[model samples]
Target: MIKKFLFSTLIALCSISAVNAQSKVKETNKLEDPDNLASQYFSQVMGVAVDATSNLKLYKFIYEWIGTPYRFGGNTQKGIDCSAFTKAIYDKVFNTTILRNSRDIFSMVNPLPKDELKEGDLVFFKIKSRSITHIGIYLGDNRFAHASSSRGVVISNLNEPYYSRYFYKGGRILDSVKDELIEE
Candidate 1:
């Protein structure tokens, strides 16, 4: 009984430590300046050395994909939605898996005020309800890239009357997330 109790206590302690660490990371790392420790990773099997430049390539790739059609279950050059576009960028840039949609994505990151918005941060909107229904990548000059329903892919501004009213949350992923692409 004592051994079981000790094991349970250890597990509980570990969980608390993890939660605390996440909170601290969230507070310290701004979406604007995230750590980029992964840039030095080497793939000996492929005889390739990936570096910070990969992020730029990824960004340009996503930008080029602008105007692709929005499809329900899509992840191709042909079509994609807001969440899928964000996921595709992260997956390609950082080689990570994010939750499938906007609401789930919101919970994984920390929200920031609009003035702190940074490039690459996920911006969310509560279009239909309190739950976030849409997401986009924060591109500077107050513009964001999103897969609009009627417009396919598009760049939107926070100053836009429609988006300004629907704006709900702006989140910045912490550096310690061990995921998501962070441009160095």
Candidate 2:
């Protein structure tokens, strides 16, 4: 009878310790996860509650490419142009390949009114010229990320006077290309 009671007590104690250890591990994981941090950062940036799973992949790519410097014809991480940045992002995040220049990409998709823009859409600008010279990936909530000649890779509000004035049209991925853009 005494041995049975002692065994029961030992099992209860071990189970309690296991539960406590699991709780601590979970807390540690939450703190250590880069995705968790990225999600929190994006939530703060967007000023809205971001769904971690739905948008985490997109945010991860943005976070990884943040601060890449701008180069007029550059296409790699060392230095990338606005359209190249958009192309790289689409290729990496959505598994979509797009044209290298802003004009070609702008022509590929159907135009959407500003009010109709959605995440993953492309935003074009006629910066410093009459034709489409710049492009960015729309990130919802009036924010877009691009490789700015002056600022490198950065997120900016579309409502900024400079962007607003230069804004041409927003483009959704073409239906033909949609089949090519496998979700990563």
Candidate 3:
């Protein structure tokens, strides 16, 4: 009986030690994760280049400005149109210029199937006439971000009847190397 008690105690102590070691390892891992530090750095860089990041936030801000008013050839928080919105966003973010309109933007970016689309990618629509008519920023989960004339900055699902019918091509910008992108 004494031997059994000693063995049981030994096992208990070993299990306790193992649990403590695992807890320490988890804490160490939390500190070592690069994603944790990179997010802080990304916030600083994004602020400095607020006008030049990527597709999503630029369009996100544009969507916020929707219903401010639409003016011909205007580009500002006060007023903007389809082409103007697209041009202004790309110009501000990444400091690159996009093709003037829906058709041009559709043609400029690399073509990728809708199934392969991800966040910050461009979704083009073929409305009215063919040749691409509207553009939105893909938000993943089959939803996209865009500045609707009526709803302003909003997320729309691709499954929606209107969007599903007009959906055509998705544009993925492969310009930046993976190492070049600040993933945080």
Candidate 4:
């Protein structure tokens, strides 16, 4: 009985110390500049390496659309679908217009191998069926922003087990949206 009590007390103390240390680390690392804070937060969320030139507009759309509720065939902040969300992002950030459906966009662009994916490239997934059923914008460093059927708009790692398994291909819009491709 005494041994059990002592062990429980030790575990509780260790857990509290760990929580405190994590809070301290978070406090120390908090960014002051809004741009820097956004960049840092997105880098961590997307599992990407952010630099000075990281696209702020992309982050802008992601932050704006985050937590939107999913709705089939919808295209507004009140509710949105995956393809609609992708199209809106491209239209807003890149000034590029894309097809409103996942498969159409997949068919429209130059298909690329996963290894060749870059920021602004479209990442496609075949979640339920064999055809491309979902799409997201790649944000480099193996991260992509997508509107999930359940979770709405979110940034997720391509290497995540579920996404990795469903990932079909990456698509680049150089030819399709040549005039709108933002030259960096």
Instruction: Report backbone clashes per prediction.
Output: 0, 0, 4, 0
In TM-score terms, candidate 4 sits at 0.74
Residues 30-84, model 4: lDDT tens digits? 6556778888886776567766688888877887898998899899999999999
Q: To one decimal, what is the Cα RMSD in angstroms of model 3 from the true structure?
A: 8.2
Q: Give the C-alpha miss distance for residue 92 in model 2, angstroms.
A: 0.8
Q: lDDT at 63 for candidate 4?
A: 78
lDDT of 2: 0.85
Provide the RMSD of all predictions against the true structure, rounded to 1 decimal: 18.3, 5.9, 8.2, 11.0
Clashing pairs in 4: none
Which runs of model 2 end up more than 4 angstroms from their true locations? 1-37, 45-49, 180-184
Put down candidate 2 lDDT per residue, 1-184, tens digits, no spaces: 9999999999999999999999999999996888777778877864534555546777778778889888899988899889888988888888778889899998789999888988789899998798998899888888888899998989888999999999999999898777655543
What's the lDDT for candidate 4? 0.86
lDDT of 3 by residue, 1-184 (tens): 9999999999999999999999999988865765544433433433221222334445445445545565555566666565676666566665665667777677667888889986667888877665777787775668775655665444578889998998898987556533234452
The alpha-carbon lDDT assigned to residue 150 of candidate 3 equals: 61
By lDDT, is 1 or 2 better? Answer: 2
